[model samples]
Target chain A: MQQRGRGRIAYPYIIWMAIFIVVPLILILFYSFTEGDIHNLKDLKFSVSSYKKVLEPIYLKVIGNSFVLAGISTLICLIIGYPVAMIIANTDVKHRNLLLMLFLVPIWMNFLLRTYAWMSLLSPNGLINRLLLWLGLPKIEIMPGKTAVLLGMVYNFLPFMVLPIYTVLSKIDKHVIEAANDLGGNSVITFIRVILPLSVPGIVSGITMVFLPAVSTFVISGLLGGGKTPLIGDLIEQQFLSSRDWHFGSSLSIILMIMILISMAVMSRIDKSPPEEERRKI
Target chain B: MSKNLIELKNLTKRYNDMTAVDSINLTIKENEFVTLLGPSGCGKTTTLRMIGGFEDPDEGEIFFEGKLLNDVPAYKRNINTVFQRYALFTHMNVYENVAFGLRVKKVSNDEIDRRVKRMLKMVDLAGFEKRNVDSLSGGQQQRVAIARALVNEPKVLLLDEPLGALDLKLRKEMQIELLDMQRSVGITFIYVTHDQEEALTMSDTVVVMNKGVIQQIGTPEDIYNEPINRFVADFIGESNIIEGVMLEDYKVSFDGLVLDCVDKGFALNEPVDIVIRPEDIRIVVNPDEGMIKGTVTSVVFKGVHYEMIIESDKREYLVQRTVMFPEGSVVGMNVQPADIQVMKRGDVPCSKEEEEG
Candidate 1:
């Protein structure tokens, strides 16, 4: 009886999603295929000029730079976050909550403020460089470049990577690990064979979380990279706001959306098929 | 070679102030199916974990095949466990889970395949090599767990209530199958369970434990027919424990009535506890034909027999009889001499001491 009424309760959420998610996506698609100001679509003419403009060498380089930096930051988050998640998940119950809170506390701060903080720290004469100089180390230039942007991206997205992996790791049945040991598997072998494979869902979600925002981040690049490294997000923003070219900006958004979707599909497919096939194999 | 395959000497484990397994000394012979039977918090699983090297005792030494194994890790020790929940790798298929031990040993793939298939076949899961472990039923998962443990050919196999998840019918079937598997594998099986019937049905020796101490260790018949104290008698099966006194050699008295019994170790006129199995008491229609007379207060149909609570003048006796005696019916109950077991009152290490002292 309760189940019959449950469907009605979800109607509000369905309507909200249609208005917020599906309608906006359809609008973007419609704008990407037409030429004119998006708000004045009454005289809009359908064309491929925006898509043609997206493949230009300059915009293509910006997209490539976006991919490279985002990929690097995501990889770094995974490397740093997996062990952090593992340690937090494996900690005793009393300390686990505190450790997780510590990892997530930075996320509560404003995203732009966090990036600006990194900008100050990565400046040429900042605290980190001063510390390096005091230690008789060579001072290095970091800010106003890809390194600074990467640092900001990694710092901002790390908690996203850690939380999901932690959830998966902690939910693992401890007896399964003991069973592995009983089967004569050492710690390393048990982790590789049991723990790691079981944690794939978390890892995949963590990757998506870190990668998606990192790919389209305009603020981090603007604040830290000082416009020296313009990502696709910056290009799209320039077209929409500065250059007043909604068609080009909408096309970039469409491409970014497609890329995110394709990657997610590829990742989830990678996550699902191998485990299924391995289990199905005799 | 040592006669015992595994020996635990003065093993004790404590969690905070509460003792989990206190000074347990047990020796397991090779190829013996021994069960650690007890109540839920009775240290049976703790003792099994100690043997499996999952938990090290706070005080004591463990020996495996006469070699000191106190510091041996679980993976290093030749011991495998079938956990209560089966603990089969959900990410792996039946074949992979079964072949896990061999693959860890770095055995040849061909040999691993052959042995995994053989083990699966032995467990009656011949065609389930490709099935995911979570897709299998409770009984099938249990079989997979057993197969995974046995395929390693460990010297000892520890089972921590592996059949507890299954239904009664499946539990019974698995109990017999486990016994058969133990016989065929010829490895020491140290099974843990709270169910007395499962322990009795499968184990060659049953170690009855309670509140961190072994109450008694004996064969099923010895445990049932000659339980050392009230705890073992009550834990193993239903029994009518009446306070009694040993009158002399081969005689005891309960409820102001003298009765002939086989036990004779107690001093003359000394306090004792008498245990008579419910099935041992014969319910008769004539009051003059039996030793004690009572009116049936309640009768529960227990499939094979009727469990009737018969109230005599001093105490109530649970009598199991195939002959149905209606409630409120006056009936006579008879106890044969050999069926009555007498033991010292302060024998169990449980609450019996607090109660009787």
Candidate 2:
């Protein structure tokens, strides 16, 4: 009875979720299946035309580009962030917190502000080109393209990758590593045979955290890509706001959600498989 | 006599201002079950780690098989350790954990499989090859850890209190199994533990330590019957340690009574510490029939024996006997000459002072 009474305290939160989250999702589902004025219930008629339009070549390309760019950005973050996390975790306690704080300092600022800061640096007459010219290097052209967009995604999401991996790596028992050394494993071999396998759960969560945000970000593509590269996120935004095509936008949003759910399912499977089974497959 | 497998020449380790292991020399023979036994922070584990090549001694040399091993890394040394917590890799299965060392050396698949299977079988976990390490109980994980280290067949196995986490009954059972395994394997085992009984039960030689220094190194019988100091006597088992004066060879005087003892080599009238084991003190029904008389203060039933505390000359003596002496009853306590152990007074504080401190 006490547990039941305590559970009632969550009723307010449940109602808030129903009104804010569940209602919007249901409206989007309804919009995806109907055509006509959204404000008028009688004018809305059931239709599959928005779903059919999603299958078009142009829209499919936008969806494909979003996934490819997000995948590359997530990979870059893992490559750069993993070593940084390991270094931070291995440092003595006196400096570990300071290093972690430094890594998180940039994240405290607004996300959009950070992306806009990248734009000013990557522009044609930007600080980067000025520094390159001063160093006797040729000016490079990288902005207003997928490369700039990818850079923005990686820069914005690198901390997401590092934090979880650091938490896991730091929690590993020192004795386990010592045991590995006692079992004739050198530093490099011990990392492969023990530490890396143990940190897979962190890697999976890091991938999800970085990839989900990178895939759906419209601000980075807008500011860095200079309206030249349009991803699925930009396409969906244009449909709802500029084109006034809520039906097509809702359909695209549903597809993106399904895609994310599928990727998450795959990531969880990788996390759930025992490290021994993973080795056998290799 | 067997050959000396490992030797420590004044090994010492320090952590900043505090010394963890003081300068101490030791020799461990091949095929010997040696236990570095002591209370926590007594440097037993630190000494074991130095031998395992996990910790480098600040001052002194380690000789393994008569070779200088000062600069040898842990991985390069031909020794393995079963950590106190077992330290089994949680990401791996039982088979993979046992096969870890073999795979590190690039042993053939068939050889690894055969050796891992045999090791698991030896630890009595034959069919648990594919079981996840985290799924096992504490005892099973302990067995897997032992299997993992033993499969490598290192010349020496350093077990850092392998049974410290088990229940009392399981610990007792594992003690017997470990002794049997050591005999069958025929390798030197350097075990570290704070439990004196476990050390006495399993070790061929027990090195009793206190404050980073070895107090005594001897067989269980020798350490019990012939402790060299007050610390060893108080640590190994229940004992009534009292200050006494040596009258001459084969005699000592304590509490205004001269008693016959089997210790000598001390100068006449030298102050010494006398150790009388609780079980060694016999209670006589007739007060005058014994050497000393005291009133029984308390009695406690301890399964196999009755433990009684007797007050004589304002000093309490702990006595263990099969027969119960009721409280407030006057009794005579007698100790044989052989059971009375005497040693020169050392710097270690007495049990009473230690408790007060």
Q: Clashing pairs in model 2?
A: none
Model 1 over residues A1-282: C-alpha lDDT tens digits? 899799899999999999999999888898889996556658899999999999999899999999999999999999999999999999999999998888788989999888878877879998889999999999879789888888889999999999999999999999999999888889999999999999999999999999999999899999899999999999889988899898899999999989989988999896886574374473
Per-candidate TM equals: 0.94, 0.96
Question: For residues B1-357, what per-residue lDDT tens digits would candidate 2 score against the true structure?
Answer: 999999999999999999999999999999999999887778989999998888999999999999999899999999999999999998888899899999999999999989999999999999998888889999999999999999999999999999989999999999999999999999999999888889899999999888889899999999999999999998888899999999999999999999999888999899999999999999998999989999999999999999999998659999999989999999898999999999889998534222210
State the lDDT of candidate 2 residue by residue for A196-235, as single tens digits.
Answer: 9999989999999999999998989998998787988998
Q: Which window of 10 residues has the lowest lDDT sum in candidate 2 chain B?
A: B348-357
Clashing pairs in 1: none
Q: Output the lDDT of residue A126, model 1.
A: 86
Deviation (Å) of B326 in candidate 1: 4.1
Worst 10 residues of 1 chain B by lDDT: B348-357
Model 1 stretches astray by more than 4 angstroms: A1-7, A36-43, A276-282, B326-329, B347-357
Residue B123, model 2, lDDT: 97
